[model samples]
Each structure stands twice: as C-alpha cells, then as structure tokens.
Target chain A: MYIESQHNDRVREWARLKTRRGRQKSGLFLVEGERLVTELLASHVHLEALLYNAALDEPPDAVWNHPKSVDRRFVLSPQAFALIADTETPQGLIAVAAIPKVDPHYPSRVLVLDAVQDPGNVGTLIRSAEAFGFDEIVFGTGTVDPYSPKVVRASMGGLFRVRVIAADPARYLAAWRRRHAQGTIVATAADAAERCDRAALGEQLALVIGNEARGVSDALRALADRTVAIPMAGKAESLNAAMAGTILLYEAYRQAANGAT
Target chain B: MYIESQHNDRVREWARLKTRRGRQKSGLFLVEGERLVTELLASHVHLEALLYNAALDEPPDAVWNHPKSVDRRFVLSPQAFALIADTETPQGLIAVAAIPKVDPHYPSRVLVLDAVQDPGNVGTLIRSAEAFGFDEIVFGTGTVDPYSPKVVRASMGGLFRVRVIAADPARYLAAWRRRHAQGTIVATAADAAERCDRAALGEQLALVIGNEARGVSDALRALADRTVAIPMAGKAESLNAAMAGTILLYEAYRQAANGAT
Candidate 1:
C-alpha cells in the first residue's frame, strides 16, 4: 500500500519515532542518507520499511532481500521527503529499523561511558571505538540515549557496527572485578597514576570516560586498576571526554599492533 | 551610563555579532557561559564588553582585574540575556572579545587541517592538540572558522590557549618542506604507508588531516614525507577525522614523552 497522505496514520507513527519516548515504545528508529542506508543493508540489522521519493535513485537490489523487508517501498512526494529527513538537504531516502539488540556481555575491550550527556559525544565515541578496534560500548546512567537522531547522524553509521548496551557503570565495573578477576580496567584522570603514554594498557582492558562536567564517578574510579592521564604541556585543563577516550583507544591499538604491551 | 532600552543600538549590535559576517566586520565574537568568560578574562585576549543579569553570583574579583578588562559591562534583564545567548539556558554571562591575532609560524610540531568542516571536529582537534602538546594549528582552505560560536564553545577555552593560524595548506606544506629541508610531513590516508601506530613519526613533524569526504588533497598528499593510517580491526571504513588526528597527536606525545625519535 502506498503512503500517499500527509496525515497517514502509519507515516505519522514513523515520524513520531523521532522522539525518545516514541522510539522506546516502538523499539524503532529512523536512518537517513544514501551511505547510512547502504550500511544498514550491509549489516545484520533488521529493516521494517524503506521510504524514498521517485525522483531519487533507487537503493541497491540487495537491500530488498533483507529478512524484515516490507511488501512495498513507499514513494514519497518532495514535501513528504522533507518532512521525514532530519537534514536540511533531504537525501530522499529513510529507513525504519528495529533497534539492534545488544547483549550485555563482559566484553574484553569495552568502553564505559559515565554520564556523557551529549548525544554527539556518545555517538562519536562509539565510532572511534569501532575504528580503533574496540568491540563493545557500555553506557552508564546519565548518558544520552544512543539511539537519538543527533547521535545516529554523528556516528556516521557506526551505530550498526558496534554493540551498544546500557547499564549502571559503577555496578558493572564492580561486577566485572568480582567476576573476571583478570581483565584490566583503566580510567582517564587529570592527575593520577602514570601518564597514558607510558602506562601499561593490557589487551583485555575496560576504558572508562566520565561526564562532561564531573569526572568519572568515584565508585567507578575506585574500581579502576589504573587511572591514567594524557600528558599536557599547554594551558588547557583537559581534553573533551570523547577525544580523551579516543586517545586511549588508539594508544591501546598502538600497543597491540606493536606487541609492546 | 546604564542603557535599559530593549531597542538600544549597542544591544542590537551585540546581538548581530552572533553571525560570521557580523563578527568579521565588528572584530568581535560572543563567548557565553561563565567558564569561557572567566578563561577569556584571564587570557591576553581583549574583552570588548561583558553582559550579564543580576541572577549570576558575582565573579571573583581577580577575574575582572586581568590585564584585558572589558570596556563596558551591562547588567540586563533575563529576557535581554536570552536574546544574546546561543544556549537555551543562559548562563547569565556573555562577553564580546576581540579576536586574538595569531602569529603565523612554521613550528616543529604543527597540525594542518584540510577541509575538515565540522565546527565540533575543528574545536575538539584544537583541544586535543593543546592537551597533547602540539605547538600550532594551521587550517587549510575550506576548513571551518575556529572562532565561530559553535567551535569556540566546543573548544572549552583551548582557543585562548593555542596558536591557530589559517593558510592555504597545500602551498604552506610545499613551502615548509623547501625551507626546513628535513622535517617529517605525515599525512593520514586510508590505504597507504605504515600503520600510524608503527610509523616512525620523527621529532620535527607536521601532521595533516584531510576533508571529511575526500581525505587529503592530492597535492598535499604528494607533499607529505609519509602517509599513514590508524589500523582498524572492526568493520568501520574509517575513523572520524578528529579522532584520527587526536590518536596521532597522543602517539606523538607518547613518543616525545619517552624521548624516542
């Protein structure tokens, strides 16, 4: 069936998923842009529907073969396309997909986010972790929702590539310490322990980043095996939390690549 | 002379400085939030004016006595404060400051940006450079203006602490090579040179980051002493440019901290 009406109930329902509450209720989120749609098709993600304007180019034939593909791909008018797209310049394509289920596993190289309220930061960190070879990201309480539109855009399709699970970071860290008994937990701090450059970051590590305003929670910090800092020579007090975590992730990659650690 | 009129010419002029053209013509830019204002006051930057509402707790006396005192300070109503602040929650303080003139110099450790257009990326890169001890940042053509409000806010006061100058990056790199005769010029590429982790990044280096879509310009790449990439194990095609640069910067910092060549 074609979704020709602007006030169509199904169309409005998909549009409403832009809100956090609506997305949670439906367990669905929207993806835009040709590149992102292409990525979603390549990944093992389930797409409920794909919408595009006839004027725009068609998506690849492979996109239609996904297990959850709906019967019809709607052709929206230019106006309808504009309404659906988050970007000012509509890419003329959008997909409604169920949020990928993330298993709450004790990942070997995990990223722990503590109250990183900016959706963009959360998203960029996920992208960086994926880029630098980290497998899983765990968001602590007070962090922004990973599925927010801003984060999904900022991540540049990283949302589909990484496992993102949410939990109370302090409790998770405590539990990991009690269970794993062998994994290393490194947290970034301004003035503590050895500098990150010189620290012995082992392969099985959990890196923790904290809130934009407050540093890592005291409980999380207390549970860390080491609190390392990126050394500074300039007047700036600290790096952005995302950048801080990226630096550490790359550092770990460097050590692993060189077989130094 | 306290001016209370909503239509006051000065108020109107200050409000207009929010735009790039307005900032260029007036040689002033807005810094909102108390933390940035405090940093601006402490730096050598010239404060054109300071505007705040009575609700804010008075800043420490030392903040106002910095050599660059505001030419004027206005206490406005909350409504007036909202008109000037970019943020929804006005921090009750905003200052207009003269753009600091950066002395263009070819330093041993410099960051060269090419068309990295995201204001947040530029800002965070500047912050990372400051944290990891890079000396100067040189923006190529097509790069976003570092002084834009969004960039300044994301920088977290790194703007005041770092030396940032703009230049045609391609020509600058070519000229620097001829002048220095032996400095290492490292450009990041997806499919070239050694992995960034194992590259022999030397003491005297200029790190170049490229556009978000195209990577580095062909001319700039040709000028590079070597091209390197951050090794990736995950399915991500590439790292965010700022994250890639931050990783490279911390690698440099690590090498330097260890006194390794």
Candidate 2:
C-alpha cells in the first residue's frame, strides 16, 4: 500500500498517536526505530499497522517478513513518513501496537510509581523494575503515561514484557494488604531511617518510588509497612528518583536471591 | 553593569561557553537557573561573572549579594540574555564559573568514565559517584566533556564538589596499582561472572564504568584487576551505563561502610 499524501486520513491518525490524548482515545501507541519495532513484533500484543518510508532503505528482512499479521502495512512517501515520525533522524520503520493490558491478578513483586514526572525516570524505573523481577507496575495518580513515546523508548523493550496498569495506588495497596498479610509494602524516602540494605524486603514486595521533588505522597507513605532510605556516605542530600528506585530494587533482588540460597 | 547588545565581545564570549570548544578555551562554564547559580555562589570555584535578565525579576538577595566576589556583574537586555541563556524558560540568573581545577593528589575512591558519550549519563555518574563517596572522576579518552552544559546541569551541583581530571585510564590504573598494590581496579561488563554484590570490592578502589553501546575498552579491561557484573534476575540484557555504574558504586559504598563498622 502506498501513502503518498501527508494529509491522508491514516497518516494523520498515526501522527496523533504521538500525543497522550490520541494514544488514549485509540488505545494504541507507536513503536519507532528498528530495535523497538522488532521488539514490538516479537511481543504478543496486537499490531494494528506497520509503516515504512519508501524514501529510506528497506527495513531488515525479519521486520518486513514477520509472520504475525498486521491489520495494515503502508509504504509512505518521505513527506507522509515525516508526519508520523517522532525522532529527529527517522529510522523509517514504525509500528502501531495496542497498549498492552493485563488481567487483574496479584504478583509476587510489584513497582508503584507515585507521580514520577520525568519521562526518563519513569522509563528507567520500568526497565529496572523488569530487570529486577517486578512482575507488575501500578501507576498512581500524577505518574507520566507509561505509553508516552519517551517512556516507551527509555524502557528499552522492557515495557513489552511487564504488566502495566493505571489505577489508584491506594486501592492496589489495600487489596494487596488484604491478600498477602505477610508481604511488605516498601516506600522510599530521602529522610527515612531504616537503611534499605538492612530492611526486610520480603519475598513478596510492593516497592513505591515517588516524584523527584515532593517525594512519596503522604497517603502512600502512611500505607507503607516501612519506609527505607539508601544510605549515602557523602554530602548529597538524595539521589534522583530513578537511581534510588533501581538501587532499592537491586537490593531487594539480592536479598531474595541470597535468602533463597 | 549593563550590557545592551548581544554583539558585545563579552556577551559573545559567554555565549560561546555553550559549546565544548568554547568551554575548553575559556576554561569556564555557565550555571543557569536559581538553584544552580546559588550553589555556584556557595562553592569555592571562582565565579568569573554573573548575568541577570533585566526584563525578569531581581535575583534573590543571596545571589545579588553573594559574599564570594565575582569579576563582573551584568544586567543584560532580554535579547542579550537570550544569547547567553541555555534553557527555554530562562530563570533570569546565570553564573560563569571557572572549570574547577584540583591539585594532583591521590584519592581513596575514583570513578573512571571510559567513552561514556551520553551527556545525561556522564552527569548522572558524576552525581552518583559523589553521593557514593567516589572522591575523583577521571575522564578516559573518548568520554564526553564533564563541563558540557547538559552534563553540568544533570550533575546537580555534584560537579562542584568532586575532583575531576582528564587522563588515559591505563596511566591512572598503573599509578594507582603502584601506590596501592591491594587496591582493586574493577571494571564493569555485562558478561562478567562475579556479581557486583559478591565482588571483593576493596576499601581503596577505582571503579571504571564504560560507554552505553560498548562495554569497557579492551585496554582498560585488561588493566582492571577484575571485572564484575550487576546480576539481573529478570530477562533484560543490561542496565543503562549510568544506572549500572550507580548500582555498583552503591555496592562498593555498602561494603566499605559495613567493613568500617
């Protein structure tokens, strides 16, 4: 299929996916560049469309010939492709995939983002959470959209593997407490007294990381079983939200692995 | 006191500080925003000049009357300020500070950046290195300039506190080995067998974190006493360079602090 005009209905629609409102309305987000598109094809999510720039080199064989069927495939003129591209230097490969949804179920470990505002921080948290074995991610009020282009790119393909849901963290925390009485709900704060390395981050954990400025919300902090801080020997008042969360996740993973052995 | 034209020689010179070459030749970098300028005033680094947007509100008294004398203070026309301002929304405050120079002295802990090209990553590593008690930062051959605007911004004032130098890693590693025979020159790699947590990270250590695309340089890795990896429980290939370096630094700090007790 050829999309010759930038004003084509399909082209304009794909371009809208760059914004949060467009993504939410369509229940789809774009995966750009060869690496991300390849990851999208490998994932089980429904692929709505695939677009390649006719002006640029052809995509790799694996991408062009992926067995999974897409609803539509288009070879777009350079002008049309420019409207749909998010990056400065377009890689000429793009995919429209349904934002993943997972069934409601308790997980052994979860990551809770309480208004992590930076796209890079949110994306890094998702990537680190997945790497350290957090089975699910719950977005609290004010958190950046996990499907935002920058967040998705920063996730480094980890977004495809993890279960992400938007909901009130309070509701999830309450439900989690009811189900797993033995589990720990750990909230991180710069001022917290219990050192993270010494804290009892149990087998089942809900790690809550907060915004860069205000820190964990009062409501969330009150719900947490314990608040832990990463001990800093130097004079820095605190680490950025993503770095703090990643270090805590690693500590939790390390403790669990060591304990199991 | 008043600079009305962007074409002024001083304004042009300060504007050049936005680029790497300009910063290198001037041996100065701009610190923008209220918080950073305030930090710059408090730091021991020489404040060459201070510029304020005449159209914007007056700078806080702390900045306007900073005890550390500056070479010159300018009230710039909004157009003139735009020439020197880096951010989209200029805070009306910026300081030109000398790129800090530290006397050559051996430090207990060091962070070596080997070709880490990302400005944000380099800045973040500087922040984490300072927070985790890494005393000196050595820039390897291919590393990004620490004084780059993006890097200086991301460093969150840690750049002001830490001693940073540019030199070949092989020379530093060899000299460190000669002086402290037991010191561990640990390099990070994705494929290394020893987990970061389990590594015998000694008290005196030089931690080498490499580029995002490539791991540590083969030459640097050869000089390393040992290479350790951050063990991941989930399927993601590896953490980004800054995140990986921060985690390893935390581990090393944890060990030293615990051992000291």
Candidate 3:
C-alpha cells in the first residue's frame, strides 16, 4: 500500500532509524540507497521491511524480488521518502533491519577500535580489515556506531561479511592474553623505534586502532603486549587513523602469506 | 577594525571564497579552524587577510599572532563570521590566502590522482603521499580541486609541504616515459597476476590512482608500464580508494628503502 501522510506512525519510525538513539530504541537501523539495499537482499540478514518510493525510483521495484517472509513492504510518496532517506540524493529505496544479531565469536586476527569518532574512518577501517583477512571487528566504548548510515555506506558491503560487536576492549583482551600467551597485541605509535615490519607479528593477533587526535589512550596502551611504528620517510607527523590501521593489517597479511616476519 | 555588517564589501568577498569559481576569480580561498589556521600562518603562504569572530571563538585572538604584512585583518561580528565560514561549527578564525604558486617539480616518487572525487579521500591521499616521501601530487583532469576547504582540512597540513599541480595525466606521464625508460609506472588492479609487493618497484616511480567507482580509466591504464594487484587473502572483492592507494605507496616506500625489488 502507498503511504502519503507524513504523520503515519510507520513512516515516522523509519525516519527515526536515521539517528543513533532511534535505531537503539527500536532495535532497528536503516540501510539506504540502491547499492546497500541490494547488498542487504543478497546477505542472510533479517529484513524488518523494505521502504521505497515506487513512483520515483527504478530500483528495488526493478531488481528486488520481495521475499514472502518479510512481512512489511511499503511504497512511500516522494514527500515521505524525502523525510525518511539519509542521503542527499535518495535512490528511492531503504532496507530496515534489526541490528544484526549473530553469535559473537573472537577470531584469531581481529581489529579493535578504541574511541574512533569519525563514521567515514570507522567504515573504511571495517572495509580494510575485511580485505586483509580480519574476521571480526571490535567497536569498543566511544567508537561511532557501525550501523549508522554514513558508516554503512562507506563500508561498501564489506561489513556484511565481517562480524561486528561492541564490548570493553581492554577486558576482552585480558581474556585472550591469558589463552594465547604467544599472541601479539600490537599498537601503532608515532615515535616507537621498532618499525611495524621489523616486529614479528605472529599467527595469533589482535591489533588496536586508536582515535584521530588522541593516540591510543594511556590505560589502553598499557594493555598492549608490544608497539610498532610505520616508518615515515618524510616530514608528515603521522598517517591518519584509517591509513595506519590498514598498513598494519596489510603487514600482518603479508607476513602470514609468506613465511617471512 | 571591527566589522559588524555582512554587507561590507570585504566581508562579502571573504564569503564568496567558499566557492571554486569565486576563489578562481579572487585567486584566494578560505582555511578555517584553529589547527588549520595555525598551520597556514606557520607556512610561508601569502596571506591576503585574517578574519575572525571577535565575540564567540577563542582562536583568532588566543592563538594567532598578527603577521605585520598581511594587508587585511578584520575583527568581524559573530553574524558576519557566520556568513563567511564554511564548516558546520565555525571556528572563530579564517585565513584568506592566495592559491599557492610554487613550481611543482617531478620527484623521483610521484602520486598521480586520476579523477578521485571525494574531498576527504583526496586529502587523506595527500597526507599519505607526504608521509611516504612522495614529493609531488598531480591532480589530473576530473579530480576535485586540491585547494577547497574540506580537502585542506583533511590534509592536516601535508599539502603545505608537498608540491601540487593540475595537468592532463596522460600527457604528463608520456613526458616521463621518454625520460625514465626503466622506471616503473605502477597501476593497481584487483585481478592482476603480479601482487603489489612482488612487483619490482625501483627508485623512480609514478603510480596512477583511479576514481572510486570506476577503476583507472581505459586510456590512463594504457599508459601504465606494469599492473600490480594488492593481494587479498579473504572474500572482500576490493579495498576503498584511500586504503588501496596508501598500501601501494607504503609498498613503494618499503622497496625503495630496503634495496629490494
């Protein structure tokens, strides 16, 4: 059925999914645009609904075969779409889903984010982690919500394959530290003497990525088993958070692929 | 002198610098925020003026030392400052400066950007370019202007150190092909047989980074002497533009430093 009224309760709830508090309160979040909605359909995710402006856009109507089990599918008026869509140029489709619920299993190689505030950075890191074989991403306290629209878009369907969870990173590491005494918990520093490649990153690893302005927090840095630095050949003070984390992931991937440290 | 009206010709002109054509007309652009403004003053950039909100923000008075030769300095009212600023939260200060005119020399190491459009991605690549010892960044046809406010902020002062220029990439690269017959002209592809690190990168290098959606254009890819793929050990089809380009830069740096091919 087509919904025309902006005052409709169903439309209001979809609009609320654009914000963090709304997503948390409703236990739902939105994945907007044709690309992301297409990814949602392809993944084994629980779809609460598929919202679209059938009169305005070609996709979802053109590409998607509505699954019989998905109980709610609504065609919205252009006005209602304008109210609910997050992107400036809405592609006339949105996928509403419960925050992805999966059994949280710790992979040997994981990327731990500590208070990363930028949504773009958070999403890019997730994409990089997946490309380099990180199986899980731990979003610790103060990190941006991975399910937010900007991050979800920036991830470019990468997060669909990687499991995401929120937990106290330091406490989580403490448990892993006891189990894998030979494992490495590496952190990047601007001035540390050992180059990232010089340090022997081993088969079992958990790398901690810090915030933009502040490096890894003092207490969190203290938890690290060792530290490594990306060698700067020029005068740049440091690489951005995303670049630094990605370089380390690449290094770990390189070492594991070849029998070299 | 304190200016209260947005109607003032000088205040109006500063507001116009927010747009690309306006900046082209005036040969100037705006840099906002305390951190960036501080970097501007410390660099040897030609300053046309300093405009600040005398009432609301602490930066213009607290951090800035009025350089004696800057021809125009105005203490603007909050309303006028609001009109002139581009950022969502206007930092109390803005610096208007001439578009940098330093002659861009071809370093042995160069990063050629081909239509990579996102301002944040452009800036982050510039930072990585600088960090990895790339001496020049060439903004080829269809790429975003390097001097825009968002790119400037995201660059975090790295663009200040590196030489930036705009040219048709194919023509510029053709000139290099004559000079360095043995030098590696690297382009990244996801399916290429040679992995990035396995490629014999040398002291002289030019790498072409393509647009986000479409990989390097057909014509530009033809100019490349060698193609190297970043080895992905997992299911991710590709990495984002910034991450992909930065990894190539890191690999180039490592090879050059280690006397390895």
What lDDT does each candidate get? 0.79, 0.87, 0.82
Write candidate 3's Cα lDDT for B138-196 as tens digits.
89999998889889988987777788888899988877767777777888777678888
**Native interface contacts kept by each candidate, as a fraction:** 0.78, 0.72, 0.71
Worst 10 residues of 3 chain B by lDDT: B61-70
Residue lDDT tens for model 2, A61-162: 888788764447789999999898999898998888898767547687889999989998988888898889886899889999988889889887888878
Candidates 2 and 3, the one with greater TM-score: 2
Best by DockQ: 2
Instruction: Give a tens-digit lDDT track for model 1, residues A85-170.
Output: 77787777788888987766776778889889987778778888897778778878988888877888878888888888888887
Q: What is the C-alpha lDDT profile of model 1 across B179-230, one tens digit per residue?
A: 6677899999887758876777887889999887899999888888899887
lDDT string for model 3 (A1-261, tens) is 679988899999989988899988998988887777777777777788887786674554543565732557778888888888988888888888878876547668888999999987888888889889997898989999988989998888777778888889898788767777888898777766788877888888989988888878787789887878887787636487888888889988988887775
Using all chains and alpha carbons, the TM-scores for the candidates as numbered come to 0.84, 0.94, 0.90
User: Which of the predicted structures, 1 or 2, would earn the higher lDDT when compared with the native?
Assistant: 2
